[model samples]
Target: MTTGPRGFRRALNRGIPRRNRTLVALVAFTVVLTAAILVWPTVAPLTGLVVPLLLGSILLSPRQLPWFVVFLMVMLMLAIGRQQTIEVRTVIAIAILYLLCFIVLVTSFRRTRLGVAGVLGESMLVDLRDRIQQQGGIPPLPPVWLVETALRSAGGTPFAGDFVVATRPRHSNRLEIALVDVSGKGEQAGTRALLLSGAFGGLLGALPPEDFLPAANDYLLRQAWAEGFATAVHLSLDIGTGEFEVRTAGHPPAAQLTAGAGRWTVHEA
Candidate 1:
């Protein structure tokens, strides 16, 4: 059966922390070497040997394999040198090959980082959101059910039609929902939208419209470089009172529909 790296990761599952320490060390070493190469290219030839050394160390564990591969690219580039070597055609061919390889490597690393960040970020956000809702001093009588979607939509293109839903407590009850169209799309948009949905869901229970708006504003400002902010609305209706409270935070106005009357209204918050 397969052993080695699999065995090591399994052993790590048995409560040993040293395996994690080793992985961190290897990653840090790779980052340091990459930085050194970029900042001090004069010494690049010497640091270039780190690629093979790192690869040899990979047999010690599986976690650092990607870092070693990256180091290999550094080594190859340094070997090519900046002083120029072959003909223009040969140089062009080599550059194209290197570009293709770099694209593949970077894309793979980015996807991996996204998956890891999703797990850890989701966990931390869940806890922090719960705490904020609890502190907001006026949670909804019943918890709201929320739905989050990746910004990819059904097709493989970026779209801003992301949405969230909050179901009332009873099966026969009406639902309070929020459909937010973020300012951007793709990974960055999806991540920020998810965060905004969670933050709004939690705060809708506890804070007033003004405070909630500013809170979400500050959150998004920290996330993106532009002046963009979410345009969202909070909608809720009382079963007995038949009244609603609608809040907007730079988001689009919400649409309300009545079943038998066939009348629709776009709310302004």
Candidate 2:
């Protein structure tokens, strides 16, 4: 009952519409076959070879292959009835060759699709990383270098529910940071995270340090999703004095490390 790669693949296949070039080619091939039947009655048997040839040129799903095979059989029978001395071996050889060609076509199409998807996926990741950087992910504070920092998604996916946005206001001596967790996970939560990141990034340095969290709360309240809720911690720190204030909403307490003691202490702000 679990959805693994195969299940996800099936879901994706169902969701995406594949181009039906084979159907169109089949129509054209049918027209040619009909014309041969009407105009050159003696050549009608040879014209049936074009059906399998046309089918082999395109990729086909398992469900469509049976119907195409039936069509080819019917065409072959009609061709046999119109002509004498039609070699059964020749027909079989042609069918085998067409099957091989169909397999090759399907393999090539799969490889091409996978290659294109990989390229596009990597490009999108690069763009998303650049956007996160532009929004000021893990701000650089002078004389207060971060000891360690890490961000991870729920299940090692590209999209995540948690996000951090940090900034130093213009002409101000304080650093503002917000760690937010959206209601869901994976792509859906990542979408909301991106939206909130944009909104919070804009609100962070623009508003007073004390007003930032309140503004964010108001923004979340105005959103249309009734069931959606988020947890966040907003921190404001003085670069010169090292004085800091932390605010939280439905989030865990902030922790501080005492370098000399080599221990961590939790702060409920």
- Best-fitting candidate, measured by TM-score? 2
lDDT of 1 by residue, 145-249 (tens): 332333235445332235453544344333354456666654456556556666666654354434655676677678765745667666666645566777776
How far does residue 24 in candidate 2 sit from its true spot (Å)? Answer: 17
Cα misplacement distance, residue 109 of candidate 2 (Å) = 20
Candidate 2 ranges beyond 4 A from true positions: 1-126, 133-136, 144-147
TM-score of each: 0.43, 0.55
* Candidate 1, pairs of clashing residues: 231-250, 231-251, 232-251
Q: Model 1: runs farther than 4 Å from truth?
A: 1-62, 66-161, 165-176, 222-224
Tens digits of lDDT, candidate 2, 134-244: 665556677555524577887886567788888888789888888888898687787677778889999998999888888999999899776677999988988888899
Per-model lDDT: 0.54, 0.70
> Candidate 1 versus the native: TM-score?
0.43
